[model samples]
Target: MFKLDEAKLQAVLKQLHQAIYNHERWHNDLIRTIICQQPHDHHDMAKDAHRRCRFGQWYYNDVPTEVRDHQAFLAIRTEHKHMHQLATQLLATAATKAAIAPHDYDAFANALDRLRLEIQTLSREIEESLYNHDPLTGALNRIGMLTSLRALHELVKRQVQQCCIAIMDLDHFKVINDSYGHAVGDKVLSASVRYLMDHLRPYDKVFRYGGEEFLISLPSTDLKAGHTMIERIREELGKPPLAFHGSKPIPLTVSFGLAMLDPEVNVEETIRRADKALYAAKSAGRNCSRKWDAVNSTPLA
Candidate 1:
């Protein structure tokens, strides 16, 4: 039943092609600007400095004497021009694309019956993708988390380096979600994810374990270093009130449980220890971090 109007689709595709061509032309101009503005090796420093001072004075009255060099000013000017042109051309192309012919009314109506079926299939695929992500926070769902954990286990085994796992849960999340609608609760979850991503190192991985719970994996990190990193994230999340929808902001806090994997320990046991530490954190206080102490208790089975 699915159908795409051949004539209208072809027209739209051609317009997209033209827009792409225009973008390439603008990109070439930026390259040319960079080539033309580069300073010659023979240019004297003093002369270059004077030239820079002239341009610098034009742009800013408080230009520093040290920064007033012709070659340096030329480089800055070239970069600025290149960026400005690129942005302007991009906007123009977008505007042009927006003016492309709308779908043909007659063809679209005739195609609607087919389009409905096609859209339903696409929608189902999209829903399945969403199922693998936390609906509230847009982090990996529980199934996705387990898959990633297995991958990490394999990676650590091969590399023979220490890996740290931390479980994070928002303190008093149910109370917040209950007081506000599920919509606001969803916002809080999203905001928390953003905060964690911003604070964590680029190499670290974070996943939503389940509702109001999250997990982080830190590769090449020892217990002490991993503790320090989690502490920083906890402190930052606790300090600021998250703003939502122009209303009075609400305070947010997170508790974390940390566990480290020794090369000798099994991966499953390491994860179990981290989960235990998470429970410890919940019991000790709402906002704190607990690390697994192997000497005091039996290792995770």
Candidate 2:
């Protein structure tokens, strides 16, 4: 008469057991409610009497019984009560298990995992953006230059690329601040950065190394190519004097030191050598680009 197969029959039985346990717990709650309302009454005995009378009316009326038959009927009644108690406990446990099933719990776990991954990804992106950007000039900062330098060094080691590191410093930058005020001096610095960026190749990177000093990293370039680039920037900056606050334009000039990285040298030492060449350029006359000549002891004139 049942639609279910053997396995489904077992599952249905389990579900019925749970439903029976829930019914028993509900009945118990009713008894507790009555007892609590009338604290002095022995209400459990009265409840059992009521239930037995109801059961007799519903299923045991008009039956004539022998002595053995009556005894068997009493045994069946006892078994029914025991089964009700077992069903009550099973129903409670089943409800709790359903509440925490894999379907419910796994969704929550997956959401948390996604949130954590997004947070980490955003944090890494922010760090990388800040690493290469200069706060003042909006050019690459010193740390950014170093990162590019190291990459270039590796490329050269593999014989895959040639690169030059050129250092540029504004001539008499401190004098501009002293004579024209720091605001004017800042404008000059900004203009100088723009001038350098305007003339350089799109692949080139410029860094704000220090106060009034900048570094240029040129990939796929040799010493001669680097010198040509620096000369162009110097000429551009000298062409028109930068003006501030609608006043007369002030003359702006920069000194440069160009050096190609030796394949055997480390990135830091290569930058240092370029810096020494810059010092030599400044000592020479201030508005010139000088290539590092180790054999020539005399500084540029």
- Name the best candidate (by lDDT): 2
C-alpha lDDT score of every prediction, in listed order: 0.59, 0.63
RMSD of each: 17.7, 28.8
Q: Where does candidate 2 stray beyond 4 Å?
A: 1-131, 294-301
Question: How do all models score by TM-score?
Answer: 0.54, 0.55
Roughly what TM-score does model 2 have, to 2 decimal places? 0.55
Give the 10-residue window scoring lowest on summed lDDT in candidate 2.
Answer: 62-71
Provide the lDDT at 165 for model 2: 82
List model 2 lDDT by residue over 116-200, tens digit each. Answer: 3443343343343344556445567676577788888889999998998888999998988998898889888877886787678
Candidate 2 C-alpha error for residue 120, in Å: 15
Writing each residue's lDDT as its tens digit, candidate 1 over 5-49 gives 334334433443453354345335433433354332221123333
Q: Residue 192 in model 2: shift from native, Å? A: 0.5
